[model samples]
Target chain A: MIIQDEDQLTAAVLAETERAGDPRVREIVRALVRHLHDFAREVRLTEKEFDASLDIVTRLGRLTTPSHNEVRLMAGSLGLSTLVSLMNNGTEDSPTSANLLGPFWRQGSPRMDNGESIVRSPTEGPPLFFTGRIVDTEGNAVAGAEVDVWHASPAGLYENQDPEQAEWNLRGKFFSDAEGVFAFRSIKPSGYPIPTDGPVGDLLAALKRHPFRPAHLHALIYKPGYKTIASQLYSHDDPILETDAQFGVVQRLIGTYERHENEPAPDPDVTEPWYSLEFTFVVEPGEAWLPTPPVSAQRSH
Target chain B: MIIQDEDQLTAAVLAETERAGDPRVREIVRALVRHLHDFAREVRLTEKEFDASLDIVTRLGRLTTPSHNEVRLMAGSLGLSTLVSLMNNGTEDSPTSANLLGPFWRQGSPRMDNGESIVRSPTEGPPLFFTGRIVDTEGNAVAGAEVDVWHASPAGLYENQDPEQAEWNLRGKFFSDAEGVFAFRSIKPSGYPIPTDGPVGDLLAALKRHPFRPAHLHALIYKPGYKTIASQLYSHDDPILETDAQFGVVQRLIGTYERHENEPAPDPDVTEPWYSLEFTFVVEPGEAWLPTPPVSAQRSH
Candidate 1:
């Protein structure tokens, strides 16, 4: 058979389900065939163009890595990442909104005591004390919650991407104290452009869109019996927050960084001028915590 | 924006093209947006599912190598390889039909004189004599054309995958003599299954399809000022020829192998009876000849 028309060919491929031994396999194949056929029809796809698209996808697979998540980058730039975050965290009354975990997030950050500074580079940006509480929907504090926090330095480079920085500079793991209070000092993160050098960059350039992501701090909060929240706290004043390249901006996740000077505080070892931000994350009760495979896990594999 | 509808969101993405500096970039992005949007809509895709798909693609990139064309394998199984071949070599009238250069075919095979056998392993299978001529469109001999051929062993494994086989067993590069005639002895290839232990296999399994390709020998014929023909000669009797998993079989490329036994003029070196196949290929004029990249090239950076 020449397999001329794509629709007919797709239907033929799908029709094999009638003779399939596994029902689940048949169902998945049928759905895949339908979607593939529908896509071709909707786009009025030509054989040549369809083939070119496939070639590009094949190139994407060939270009992926632990440091370079080209496929995830493609998915993020295409709005698929945002769509996923919305669908998976659609609880109406959830304390916090979730977002893309991004392709960074290295493992084994220094675990520090509450109130300890995670910032190893004091000169990179303004010192900031981040204080937050993990609580339930009813406003009850949830102590002993683990908070995984990480962010790019003021120069817009993650420790993993910068040879000058230590292994986990400005990255740390902390637990909420007995009163559900968590405090960590770190340098303020600055807005940075997503890497635009690979195929993903080519895609963004082709789309004529900017690749800048607003300054934000990444947080993954975990408390027993409460849905873990994987989210970003965006600086309210950052311009890209309004037009995030990945469409990940949520109104509730925006906050302000307040500047404080000459405050006589607990430790004189602290820098004279510093900034601070106080926020609380409310958790919802659910079993839908889909933990991302740690960066180490993928590397180990 | 929440981006509830995939089509509308895709339209928004494509609209960014108005700001593109290059017209070609704008045009390509437009087409990509349409196809990608159509794919999502056709699948009634949820955000979470799309994210999962991105994860799969990201992993694919990290698993590539020069020797392993995992991305190409994925594309071939998805019917994209055929599409790409069609795009690059439009349906112009050519003496020989083109097929996908599957994920094998390494560089640097031993060059053989005309009529010399290519099979290094005598115990591999029943020996078969293969003869072919390289001719131009008018049927005149195109002497000095190089023909590269390789196939799986009788037990059905390529040299790259089977460690037991010598480096280039059943593989050779030959030059056509002054008469455009070339011949080699090798075992008849048997129908075999594609590798089914990876994601491609997962896709095939989900589609409720077997990953069998019909018995065939891969050939790359090249001469100056002519289009290189990357093709497969399929056995006419193979059961899966009609439904090759990669959709690569063509009627014109199928050949018949005839059994010859008890000939009085048998050569002293030959002990067992064998089969024989004689076929000729016609070439078309083109620019500098370049053989199609092996499927491995698709995965190699």
Candidate 2:
């Protein structure tokens, strides 16, 4: 084809990819090309602006590391992750919901006994005793399910991000008992801003948007017959619940955090102010699968 | 507003940017967000596919360095650069056309005298004597204009990509004389593939698309009281002209390469078979502006 104009150019490019064997991939590429052309036209993107955009995208990739996934953060900040998660999971009004699997998730978290604390490192804060039950869509408990839980420290940094924290601080995996109940202990988390030294930060600054995510505990539930659910439970009292930077806070995922003053710890070994949260997760019927973690632990091997 | 669904989430993200003081930024961002969300919905982008896309983008950025710009390459491969350039320049059907300001442009190219060769190092190919005139759309010569010209070597590598070549081989800035004429001598370039070790290569491989760009010479013309035009003149007889990897080959930009056998050289330098190309660039009326060069020469001072 003689590619003289944008339309012809687009058609030529699309035609070149018409032989893509994978139907899904072909569909995606076609749609992507069409939308991208439309975007350039709709905005009349200037050459300078286009150059800047290219630099921004390149910087985003360059800033990402094994410990930090800047691309994922950008996607979440742009609401793409949230949108995709909601669309692929249950409908907006359904019970079986999913959430963004943020970049902090690490595979092979140390397996712990139920009711044990995920806080492996010493920390000072009000303790959070969390309990959750995994159930099927029919309201029946799915016993023997595996629940992986993780959260940030009181300083609002994940263990991987904090040098003072232990290797697996506030991360653990446990099997649900016969009653489909799982419990864990960790310090109550506080909202923290996404890393602002990278491209995502620059974008947030340009958009006049806050980078703080609401305090939350992450969980990944897995069972043999039901789809795995990757979710987070937002604190009911979190000040940033209304404005999570990732827009991950959903009504059904909000959990009430009951505060007690100078109450005995759940393990009865010490006395301190503490908080407790309870929530239930509903898993839908589908092929059981686990998503690849956004970030991985640095290997010393 | 609570962001429970894609529409709501998009709105929330867009609303957060409502206070951007720059109207252009706001407009571009709004259109971007809308199109991105629409693309996702239109394709029903799966979570896995989304993750792969993010990784590809990240890899593209990571692969880019001071020596290379893979993100820019990806943009060109997708035809976004060509579309934006065409849209922002003279009408698609007009003569004052623009082309992709590819990533190889280096700032501060050494200025050369009129009718001088840009080849600074030893090179092996039939010598190409290129002459061009810079004029306005009204057919008036744009005297005293600066024309920056560059091209790849016969081996399909830019001077920067090849250590054997001098720092500024096949790159020079020449001022158009009173008659709006400028000339340079260099080796004839050949079509070459873009870097194939990056994510763009993987994408092209998957789409069954070739990554070869037709042989071409690039020129950036600047004059007072005229808009800067970034353009490329393709070899008229190059087999790949119709399928330029960057989709940057336009009909008006293709130049005929005439071969002279044992004829007197344009310059009384040597007796050898040579090629000559003549092209005319049409500049439009606008503020003179220079784009940020995609790549910069490393400074030693």
Candidate 3:
């Protein structure tokens, strides 16, 4: 067909997608074409700008590897990841407990009993004892769910990114107990910068925005009868709680870390000024599955 | 600020752009974020799908190199390239002479005088004599413009892609005469399949779409007073004219290839079954600049 104008050209592409046998794919692709064409027209994007944008997209892809995912980072930085998470997991009234799994997640971390610390290496920081409850949307305990947890060290690097840290240094997994409780010990994670060495850094610099994701812990909860969720629980005390670089922060997912100086620590060897965080996760009933780890390989040999 | 919902998340991303110093970039980025979020919402994009998309993006980058650009290819497949081209050039009424530069255009081919041939090596196929005029929107001649011409051989492989072909074979540069006329000779290009061993190939398979672009001659016309248009004069008789894999076929840019069986050839040694094409390019007045060649390497040592 002769594509007479931009609208006609868009329609042609959409028409091609209809030939696909998969209805779901066809629908998603058709909607994508409309929005993409609409976006180009809305901005009156120039040839130079279009070429430059292609370069950016190429670099985002080229910069990604097993140890890092620049494409996913850019998605989070744009808030698309969070928006998708919200739309998929919960209703308008309840909001979603789901959040970005982020680029640091890996598959098959060591599993430990409840209350066992995931802090496997000599990591330095004030100790953080974390407790969490897993429940359904109706507030009933969701026991027996496997919860995989990982977080960045206070130095702003994951075990895969920091060579000094052991393999899976601040990473572990546990199952929710009969009461739907899971606990672990680790140092208080501090607000730190994201990797600014790639195209995403260029974008943040252009937007004049900081690359700090407020201190947060990542969790992926899995149970057969309920939906599995990849989540990040932001620390309420972090100053950038509202401006997380990934935009993964949700109001209800924020955990308040109580600072304690006089009370005895959870681990007898821990010093004063320790902290503790208590939070809960609400999963809905649906298909339960696991995500492929965005960065599966650790840097350690 | 705590981002409460999808709408709020979109707003927060838009809000961050106000900090950008370049209002044009700020505007474009804001629009991009909105459309991206809206696309996600319109499709109710799932976390698994989103993750899969990111994986697609990463492979698009990892597969790109100096000789190949999977990212740009995917954009062309999506029709964003043509949409951007039409949106930036001419009027909604006049349409655009500008088109995709495509992945095979290179930076410095040897320049030649008018009526010369660009077939620098042994190539198979009937001879093709291409003549074109450069004119402004008012139909006035545009003289002294440098025109770069290139096309694939009869075997449907560009010089850069086929190891047996010499560097810059079927590629030449010519300048418009006082009458705005420029012509070059090469083999009649056959429609060719795009490289399909990447994510774009995956997309095409999923869409049940073919990977062939209509046989076309590429031209880049540059003059100081008018816009530098990157164009492809698609063969009107090509089987896939209406279904170009890149979605780059423009209505007015299609050129008729006159076939001669008994007439004298343009060149003495050329056979009876040669083809000839004459077309006029209408350039709109605008800022002039060249594009970075999407692919800039030769496969041969």
User: After superposition on all CA atoms, how large is the RMSD of candidate 3?
Assistant: 2.6
Q: Give the per-prediction TM-score of chain B.
A: 0.85, 0.90, 0.94
> Where is the poorest 10-residue window by lDDT in model 3 chain A?
A292-301
TM-score of candidate 2 relative to the true fold: 0.90
* Candidate 2: C-alpha lDDT: 0.82
True contacts kept of each: 0.26, 0.70, 0.83
DockQ of each: 0.20, 0.62, 0.73
Candidate 1 structure lDDT: 0.69
Model 1: reference contacts kept, as a fraction: 0.26
Shift in Å, residue A100, candidate 2: 1.9
Query: What would the per-residue lDDT of candidate 1 be over residues A1-301, giving only the tens digit for each residue?
Result: 3234332455445554566677645665566655545544544555446546655666676666545667777777766565545445644444345666876676556789988888775446777889988777777888888888989887887777776777677789999988789988888888788767777787777666789888999888877677777888888778776556776666677768787788854456665777788887766676535465655223322
- Tell me, by DockQ, which candidate is best: 3
Error of 3 at B279 (Å): 1.4
Candidate with the larger lDDT of 1 and 3: 3
| Residue A186's lDDT in candidate 2 | 82
- Second chain TM-score for model 1: 0.85
Q: Chain A TM-score per candidate? A: 0.84, 0.90, 0.93
Interface RMSD of each: 4.6, 1.5, 1.2
Tell me the deviation in Å of residue B182 in model 2.
2.6
TM-score winner among the candidates?
3
What lDDT score belongs to each candidate, Candidate 1 first?
A: 0.69, 0.82, 0.85
